[model samples]
Target: MYAGTAKFPVRKGKNYLLRIVNAAVYNHLFFMVASHNLTVVAVDTSYTKPYITDILVLSSGQIADVLLTANQAKAKYYMAAKVYTTHSEANIDNTTTTAILSYVGSKSSTTPILPEYNDTATVTNFREASDVAILQAYHFHIDDVYTTDFPSNPPIEYNYNGDVDKTLWVPISGTRVKVNEYNATVQVVFEGTNIFQADKPSNAYSRL
Candidate 1:
């Protein structure tokens, strides 16, 4: 709810390389600069074809490298970021954080318009339109600390929307890892485990 105090000074007709990192542990972020478009060139140290958009979404711990062109009018505009949550009832801090994008020798400013907190359609379209880079190698130091025994499918399969089971209340704990080969395709499905006492509704979302 508080407008942030960060500021980035830019000159007109110049392109700035911006490296944005999402440090949140559980929330995906939607980032945008008022009246400006961002051209993304890389993600997570992997280079991709240039994808341009007005809004960018980054998952938890993800990184994006974008080019910001100071092509708008010579005035101050707010660069804002907000949480993009999938579940409507999920407890999250629904607040917007902002920074100032000031043009050289300008004083007037305006706030940027942002999407709703639960705008899943925009997030889905943004992810699907971009060509993401595939990681080939992982340099990790904890190879022995975790076992590569993560299961591909759930052990128990039931109607996720309907029944309540006592056995499914507890989750299995392990330090498991899954390794993939080069040029491999991986699909992940997150199952809702909790059963609601009331007739509350729920929603599901994925990056791809």
Candidate 2:
């Protein structure tokens, strides 16, 4: 897990780009900057209209870009990224806490204290509803509006002549048993068209 502070001089009223990448093997990441609202500008290499929020969730192999404005200059703030897990099994190993990013020197060089993991209940509650809404809107846009421009052409030609070879078939079988006694085996019939096609007019046919 990568976690450290970044120090950069900023002018008031100007927007700066903040890029976040979730490189964990199994955990998702949640990001927030202390006392500053993050305006998300892009996700997964796609541009989006900026949306202001306090927290952003990033899943594994995902990237997010946000525009952070230093509305006030020469101030210190903590930038935090924490891991999230989704497993429910008892044997699963969950990360206690991991930091991914932070902000360094400003007018002050001291680190801002962060809340304990157990103290983040309100943050989790707020993020849950926002995540659901964003995902639903994304799915609706992709399924209904974004799918209208796909090409309608068929993929393969149907006029090629081919040679015939032996056909192979497999039968299906099943059995039903009494609750506390022996079971009777039953055989079922299975039928389908099996074709073998020659390779490059030189080799023997291959079964499919």
The lDDT values for all models are 0.78, 0.51
- Per-residue CA lDDT of model 2 for 1-208, tens digit only, reads 1234354556666778988788877766666766667777678978654557777777788888988877744555556666554445353443333322223334543232343333356457645433443345455652321223222332333322343322222322212121212453433223223334433322232222
TM-score of each: 0.61, 0.46
Residue pairs in steric clash, candidate 2? 6-104
For residues 1-208, could you state the per-residue lDDT of candidate 1 as single tens digits? 3254888899999999999888899999999999999988888988665778999989999999999999989999898899998777458888888889889997888787888888999899888656432221234342333456777776567666656687776766554667766666666655455576523345453332
**Minimal lDDT window, size 10, model 1:** 133-142
lDDT of 2 at 122: 43
Clashing residue pairs in candidate 1 are none
On a 0 to 1 TM-score scale, where does candidate 1 land against the true structure?
0.61
Most accurate candidate by TM-score: 1
Candidate 2 minimal-lDDT segment of 10 residues? 172-181
What would the C-alpha RMSD of candidate 2 be, to one decimal place? 17.3
Which lDDT value does model 1 have at 89?
A: 40
